[model samples]
Target: MAILGTSYWNLIDVLKAGGDGIGDVVEALTQLTPFMKDANVITCNKGTKHVSSIRTGLPQVSWGALYQGIAQGKGDYTQVEDTTGFVEGLSAVDTRLLALKPAQAAKLRLMEGQGFLESMAQTMESAIWYSNVQLNGKQFHGLAPRYSALANGNVINGGGTGSDNASIWFVTHGDMQTSVITPENIAAGVQRDDKGEQRVMDGAGNPYYVKEELFTQHAGIAVKDWRYNARICNIDVSDVIAGTVNINALLRKAYYRLQGRRSYQMEKPGQVSPGRTVIYMNKTLAEALDAEGTNGRSGADNFIRLSPREIQGEEVQSWRGMPIRETDALLNTETRVS
Candidate 1:
C-alpha cells in the first residue's frame, strides 16, 4: 500500500474553511513570503488561549510470571498554555488627497491598506522565529528561545564561533506537532475595519478629514511536540562564502535528527502520524547551498536537488523530498550558538 502525503494548512486555509470573507486579501498579502505560505495554523478553542498536554515521559513496561501481580505505571504529562498576541496598526490617508484625485480615491485607499498588510505579514514572519515573550510581554515566545540551548535534544551545533553565523531549520507542520495559533471567534489572518472618513487634528493642530482603517492580527506559536522541529545553528557565513563549510553534511545530520521510522506512519493503530516537513534558510545560505550543488565536488551532486515544483511561480530547491524555502526573517548575522 502506498502512503499518502500529509496535507498541511495555513492561516488562509483556516479563514477559508470558516467562510471568512477576507480569504482572498489574506492570500494576496502572504503569497510572496514562503514562511507565511507554508506555516501551519490552528484556531484556539479556548477563546484567546490554547492549552496543550505534552507527554514528558513514557510508562514503564515490565514482564512478570503467570498470575503474578505487576505494578501499574503512568506516563508523565505537563500542560502549557499558549496565548495569542494582538498585532494592530492603523492606516490613515488624507481625505484632501483623495478628493484631489476623485477617480483614484478607492485605489489610493487600497494602496494604503496594502502597506499595512505587508507590514503585518513581515512582523508575523519575524516573530515566528525571533520573538522573546519574556522581554516583551506583548509578543509570544518564538522557536529560537525555545531551542536556544545547544544542549537541547533538537538543536544541532555547527561548530561556528564567529558573530556572522546563521541557522537552518527543519519544521514539521501538523496538528500534533508545531503550528501557529489564532484566537477563537476571530477571523484568521489580518482583519481590516474601515472607520470611514473622520475629522482629526494633524501634527500642526489643524483639523482635517482623513480616511482611517484598522488592521489587526491575533497569532502565536505552539510547539506541541518539540521533537518534530530541528535547528542547525552556528553556521559560519564567512566559511560558507569561502567554500569551507559543508551545509549538505549539516543538513544530513538534521534529517536524521528530525526524521524517524515513526514519522512515516499515518492513521495506523498504535502509531503517531507525522506532518509535512520543510527547510528554511536565509538568502546567503541558500545561495551557498546552490553553489555547493553545482560545485562539481565529489558526492556533492546527489545531496541537494533543484525541484521542478514552483512556489508562487518560483522554482524551489529540495533536499530528500523536502522543499527548501528562503525567507528574509532569518538573519545571517546571528551570534554563535555555543
Candidate 2:
C-alpha cells in the first residue's frame, strides 16, 4: 500500500508513542493499512472534548505619515469537539499447545495474532476512508459532505448518475485537511494476559489473551479556508480502463490547486513551510491510475506501477514520484449528479 515518495505526515502510534489525544484507536491499528503509515495522526486524552487550532484570517496594514500603530489582525480559531470511543479486537491461544509444540505453536500464535490485527487495521482504515467520503458517521463527520457544501464549485460530478465506476480523489494540503484526535486522559495500548486466565481448554491451563483498544474523534474538514482542499468526484473508471481519460492530467489539476492555496502557510509553527500534497483514492481508482500510466502508449511520462520492493519490511509500489497506495476502505460504488 506504500509508494515511492515521502508521506506528508506520520501515523500515530498510541501504544509506543504519544498522540494528539485523538485517533488513538485508528492509530494503534496502523499495521493493518500500509498507506495509513503516511498519514499525520494526533492522540488526545478524552472521549469527547473541544479541540482548538489556530487559523490565520485576513491581515491589514496602513501607510501613515505619523507612524501610529495599526490595528493588529486577530487570527481565527477553530474549535471542534473530538469524540472517540473504544474498539477492541481480541485473539486467544491455548497454553498447552504452546507448551507441547514449541516452534509450531509459536508460529501459529504469531500468525493468528497477525491475522487478527490485520483485519482490525483494515476495519479502522475503512471507517476513516468511508467517513472522508460520506462526511457522516456515528462519531465524526466526514470530508465529502463538508467540502461538498463549501460551494457548488468544489463538488464536481464524476459522470452521470448511477455510474458503475463512481470514484473520488481528495486533494488536500496539511493545513486545511481534517484533524483526528483522541482524548489525552485515555490509555491507548494492547493488553496481553500474562496470567493463566480465560481458559478455553480446561485441561490445557489458560489461553493467551490479547486485546487492542482505543478511541478517536474527527474535526471539521475545513475551517475558514476552503481552497486548500478539493474533491474530484464522478471519475469514470471506464475511461481510464479504456484509455480515454488521462490519469496524470487529473492528478496534476488537483495537485496544482492544492499547491496554490494561500491560507495557513504551514501545518504548524516551526515546521516545514511548504504544504504536503496527497491524492486520496480507492483501489479501483488507483488501479485505473496505474493503468493510465502503464498503457504502453506514447507521451506517458509519469508511468505508474513501479517495481514492488520492501520498504521498512513492507512491500509497496510507487507512482509518478508519489506513493500510489491502495486501501479497500474507499468507496468504489458512489452516485454523483451534475
Candidate 3:
C-alpha cells in the first residue's frame, strides 16, 4: 500500500488538463493494484492561487507543503546499498571499520519521491539481504528512506574470516536504494535456486535471477492477483510516459481520486472554480465581490482590503465619491495603504 504525495498546484493544472492527467497516474497504480494498495498524495502549495478539487472517486492523501520536490532532477530512479554486510575480502577489523565508513566517507544527498522510496527499501530489507536469508524465495528484502519503495538490483558480499556468516540476497527496484549500513552482518548462506543452481548476489549482499520480481517472497499476492515473479509484462512505456493511457479506464480511475477526496468538508478542501458560467460571476463570486465593495463603493478593489476611507484617507484610495474608480486595480492588493 503506497501513498504517492506530490504538489497540488500541479494538481490544479492536472485538473485543468481535463481530469485526464491524473487519471494517468491512477491507471499506473491501478495496473499494479493487484499487487499494491496505491494512492496519490497531493501536497498543496497554499501560495498558488488555483484551488484544488477532487475529480475522481479514488482515495487521495492531500496536504500543504513547500514545493521543493518539483525542482528539476528531484525525481530519483536509482538503486543503492548500505554498509550492513561483511566486507567480501576485508578483514574483520577492517570490515567493521569499513562498515562504520562506506565510500571511505559520506556525501549527504537529500532524496525525494523514488529516491526516498529506495532508501527505505534498503533499510527494511538490508538485514534479510546481508544475511543472504531468502524471504519466501524470490526477492531480497532491503531498506530505503521513504515516499516510495519498490525492488532494486542485487549484489554479492562474501568472505570466510572477517565476513563470517557471509551470504547473498536478491534485491530489485530502483526506489529501494539506501546507504544506512548497519555494523552487524547477516550470514543466512549463499543464495541458490530451487534446482540448486548457482546464483549471484549484489553489494546489498543479495542475489537474483536477473528479473525484477521475487517469485517466492511476493508469491501470495502474485498467486492471487497475477503479479507473479518472472512474469514479463509488456506495458506500453510510451502510454505510461504520455499519461494518456487507456483514457476511458484511466479517467474512471481518476474519478476515484476525485470522489474519495470529497469526504472531508474542509473549507478549501472542496474549493474549485466554475469552469464556465452562464453568468461569468456566479452567486459565490458575486456575493464575495459584493461583500467587499458593498461597505463603501463600487468595484472589487474598494471593498476588499482597506475601505475607501471616505475617498482620500489612504494613499491607495482615490476620492471614492467620484464616479471613475481605480478600485479594480487593487485586485492585486499585495500591500496595505492608509
Candidate 4:
C-alpha cells in the first residue's frame, strides 16, 4: 500500500527489465489508473498457468507422556490453478494518411497508440475485480466472484438490499497471499509489436496499404491465500451520499476480517518484503469516508482520519496507516451479495 518493494516485479519493474521503449507505454498506463500502479505482479510459475497448493486446515498437536506415542496429523491442502488470460488490441492507420502528413505522422501514430493503451488499461482494471470465469471461461475469475457469497468468512454485509450497491475491498498483495501474474517467458505489461505497412481490406472490400500495431497483455489474478483478503459488499450508494451510512464502521469490520494484521514489513530502504495491504473503493465511497473525517461525527476519530500524504509523488488517503485507493472498476449498480 505504501509502494513497498517485494521480490516479485510489478508491471513497471517488468517493463523496465526489457531496457527498451516498452517502459514508457507501461508508465503511461499505470499513471492513468490506481490499481495498476499499486498491483503486485509476478510471472506465472507454470508456462501459462500458476499452480499452487493452498493449506486449508492445520495439523493437530497433542501432548503425551515420555513412554506414550502420539499420532501424527497432516495439514489439509487444496491445489488451485490460475490461468492467465490474453487481452489483445489492434490499431491500424491508413498509410496514405501518414504520407499526407509526413512531419506529424509519428505524433499521430503515437496518439492512436495511447488511445488503445488506455482502453486496454480500463479493460484489465475491470476484469481484476469483476471478471467471472464461470460466466465466460475465456476470462479469469476475479475477487468479486470468489467472495460473492456471505458464507465466505471474509465477506461482510453492509445492510444494503437493493441494486444501488457497491463494495469495498481489502486486498493484501504478497507472494503467499495474492498477486497479479503473467505467463512464463513473457513480459508483464502490454507488449506492442509494430506490423509494418501491409495491404488491409476496408469494410467495402477495397484493398489499401495500412500500418498496424498489435498490443497484447497476458495477465491474471492469483489468490494463493484467501484469508489475506476481505470484502465489504452491499454498500448502499444513496445512503452514503446522504451521509447516513457509517462507512468507518464497515471499514473496521473488513479490517478485522483479515486473518493476518501485520501482513507487511520494511526490510530496508527501496526494498519491501511481502504482504502489503490496500483498501479499494469507488469515488463515491471514498468521498464519504473523507466527509466522515471532517464532519466531526461520533466514532470518526477511532478508525477514520483523512490526513492526505504523498506516496511516490501522488497524494494518498490512509485509514489506520493503510492506503485507500479509489477505482471506477467497483460498480455502484452491483446486485446485493446475499
Best by TM-score: 4
lDDT tens digits by residue: candidate 3, 1-338: 21112311123433442353222222121111100111111211222111223222434344546863432222223222222222111001112222333442111111112233333333333332222224323333222111011231111111112211211111111111111222222212222122222344544766432211111111000001001011111223233333322322322232232211221112223434111000011122223323444443333354443233231232322111211112111111111110
Tell me how candidate 4 scores on lDDT: 0.80
List, residue by residue over 1-338, the lDDT tens digit for candidate 2. 22112211123211122233221132344433543554444555343443545455656665766757666656566564444533354444445434444445444444445545566556556655445423334434445555443244555545534565554544444433444444555433333432333523223554343222222223322222345556666677666567676666665565555534332222445544344434567676776666666743575565444455444566655443344556666565655544
Error of 4 at 232 (Å): 0.8
Instruction: For residues 1-338, write the lDDT of model 1, one tens digit per residue.
Output: 21112122233433343333322233344533567677678998688888999889999879999999997999999998887898898776667656655665676567557867888888888889999889899998888988898988889998789898899999887788888899988877889999999887755777767788899999998889888899999998899989888888988888887744122213335546466787899888988888777644475456445454555566777776678888888888888776
- Candidate 1's C-alpha runs over 4 A off are 1-32, 204-206, 259-273, 299-304, 310-315
- What is the TM-score (0 to 1) of candidate 1? 0.83
CA lDDT, every prediction?
A: 0.77, 0.47, 0.21, 0.80
Scanning candidate 2 in windows of ten residues, the lowest lDDT window is 1-10
lDDT of 3 at 259: 16
- Among these predictions, the greatest lDDT belongs to 4
Model 3 segments beyond 4 Å from truth? 1-235, 241-251, 257-338
As for candidate 1, its clashing pairs are none
Model 4 scores worst on lDDT over the 10 consecutive residues at 1-10
Give TM per candidate.
Answer: 0.83, 0.62, 0.16, 0.85
Judged by lDDT against the true structure, how good is candidate 3?
Answer: 0.21
